[model samples]
Target: MRLLLIEDSAELAKWLAKALQGSGYAVDMAHDGQDADHLLFTQTYDAVILDLELPSMDGLTVLRRLRARGSTVPVMVLTARGELSDRVAGLNLGADDYLAKPFELSELEARLHALIRRAHGVSAPLITLGPLSYESVGRTFTLGGATLALRPKEHAVLEVLLLRGGKAISKEKLFEKVFSVDATTGQDVVEIYIHRLRKQLHNSGVSIITLRGLGYLLEAT
Candidate 1:
C-alpha cells in the first residue's frame, strides 16, 4: 500500500516512515500542509496520515478542502487534540479516524490498517486464488503448497494479478498499484518483474500468462 504522511516534525515522520516501509508499505512525506496538499493533487495514495497541528494550513482546513473537492481517499488525523469536541469536529469534516499525541505507535499503525481495510472492502488479511495463497499483513505468498520469498514489489504485483485471477490486467493498471509516482522506475520495469515471476511460476506448473498486447492473467492447472 502507498501512504501519504503529512507531518512537520522531522523526527516523528522519519520514524513512522521507516516503520511503514519495514511493514511492506510505500510511504511519502510532506513537512507542512501546503506541500501535503500539493502532493494530494499530484499523486494518489491509499491512505493519508494528517497531523492537525501543521503549519501554513491547519489539518482541519486541509481535510475540509480535500473532501470539498470530492476526494474520498481514507484519512486518519494524528494530532495533539484528544478532546471530545475536536474529535467530533474532525469526524464531521470527514476524517476517518483520529490519533492523539503521546499515543502508542502501534495504535496509529492499527488504525491505518483498519482504514485501508475498510476502504478496500477487506475485513480479512488472507487472499486465496486457486493453488496460490497470500497473507497480506505477513507479506507471504504460498504457491503450490510451497512457501516463496519474494521482493516487496514482486509480492505486490503478484497479489494484484491473483486478485484478478480470471481477468486480464493491463500493465498500466498494474503499474498504478505497485509503483508510487516518486519511484525511479520506468514502465518496462513491470515487464521485467513479471518476466521473472513467470519463470518461477513455470517451474511449479502454475501459469501467469502474458496476453501479447495486453498484460497478464494467472492460470492454475
Candidate 2:
C-alpha cells in the first residue's frame, strides 16, 4: 500500500521510511506539516503516519484541515507525547491509531495493517478468495494450502488487487501504490508485475482480469 509519513525528525523519518519500504509499502516522507499537507492535497494514499510535533503547521492542524476538506484517508498519530490528553486530542482530531515514540516497528506495522483493513471495510487479518488466502501480518499469500512465492513487486501488485477485490483498479492507481513517488521506474513496470502475478495465480480459482479502459480486476472464477 501507499503511505504518507509526516515526521520532523530527519533521522527517525529516514529510519522509519527504510523500514516501511523493506516491509513492502510504497512510502512518501514529508519532514514537516506544511509539506505533508501539500502532499495530502495533491496525492492519494492508503493511510498516513503523522507526528504531533511538526515544523510550520502542527500535526493537529494538518489533521483538522485534512478532515475539513472531507478526506477520509486513514491516519495514525505517532509521537513522543504519551499523555492521555494528547491521545484524546489526536483521536478526536481523526487519527485512527496512536503510537508513542520508542515503539516497536512490528507494532507500528500491525497498526497500519489494521488501519488499512478498516479503511477497506475488511475486519479480518486473513482474506480469502476460493483457495487463495492472504495473511496481512506476514504479508504472505497461500494457494491451495501451500505458500505462494512472489517477488516484492509482484506481491505488492497482488496485495492491492486483493484488498480491493472485485473492484476495477486503474493502472495508474496501481502504479502509484506499488512504486514510491521518487521511483525512477516508468508506469509500464506495473504491467510487468501484473503479468508476473497472473502467472503465479494461474488456476488458483481467482483471476486478474484486464478491463480495457477500466484497468484490472481480481475476481473469483
Candidate 3:
C-alpha cells in the first residue's frame, strides 16, 4: 500500500521511510504540514502517518483541514506528545490511531496494518478474492492454496489491483502506487508488470482486464 508520512525530524523521517519501504509499502515524505496537506488533496494514499509539531502548519490544523474536506483516509498520529489530552484531540479530529514517539517499529507497523484493514472493512489479515488469498501483514500471495511468487514490483501492482478490485485504475495511478514519484522508469513499465501478472495467473481463476481508455481491473474468471 501507499503511505504519506508527515514528519519534520530529518533523521526520524528518513529512518521510518526506509523501514516502511522495506515492509512493502510505497512511502512519500513531507517535512512540513502545509506540503503534507497539499499532497493529501492531490494524491491518493492508503493511510498517513502524521506528527503534530510541524513548520508551515501544525498537525492538528492539517488534520482538521483534512476532515473538513471530507477525506476519510486513515490517519495515525505519531508524535512525542504522549499525553491523554493530545491523544483525545487527535482521535476527535478524525485520526484513526495514535503512536507515541520512542515506540517500536513493530508496533507502528502493526498499527498501520490495523488501520489499513479497518479502512478496507477487513477484520482479518487474510484477504480473499476468488481463489486468491493475500496475507496483508506477511505480504504473501497464495493462489489455490499454493504460494504465488512475484517480483517486488509485480507484487506491488497486484496488491493495489486486488485492494481496489472491480475499479478500473488508470496506469498513471498504478504507477504512482507501484513506483516512486522520482522513479526514472517510464509508465510503460506498468504494462510490463501487468503482462507478467497475467501470464503468471493464466491458470488461476483471476483475471486482470484492461479497460482501454480507463486502465485495468481485477476480476474473477
Tell me, by lDDT, which candidate is best.
2
lDDT (tens digit, per residue) of candidate 3 on 1-221 = 78899999989999999998877778889999999999998888889999999999999999999999999999999999999999999999999999999999988998898888788777778888899999987779999999999877788899889878468899999988877655688999989999999999897999999999999999889
Local accuracy of candidate 1 as per-residue lDDT tens digits, 1-221 = 77898999999999988887776667899989998988888778789999998999988998998998899999999988889999999999999998889888767777787787667666678866666777655557898778977777777678667656478888877776677667788778889889879877776756788798877888776
Spell out the clash pairs found in candidate 2.
none
Rank candidates by TM-score, best first. 2, 3, 1
Per-candidate local distance difference test: 0.81, 0.91, 0.90
List where candidate 1 sits over 4 angstroms from the true fold.
103-106, 137-139, 162-169, 203-206, 212-214, 218-221
Error of 3 at 191 (Å): 0.9
Q: Kindly give the stretch of ten consecutive residues in candidate 1 with the minimal lDDT sum.
A: 130-139
Better of 1 and 3 by TM-score: 3
Could you give candidate 2's per-residue lDDT for residues 63-180 as a string of tens digits? 9999999999999999999999999999998889999989999999998999998899888889998888999877889999999988777788888999996799999999999898
Clashes of each: 0, 0, 0
How accurate locally is residue 34 in candidate 2, as Cα lDDT from 0 to 100?
Answer: 95
| Model 2 stretches with alpha carbons more than 4 Å out | none
Clashes of 3: 0
lDDT of 2: 0.91
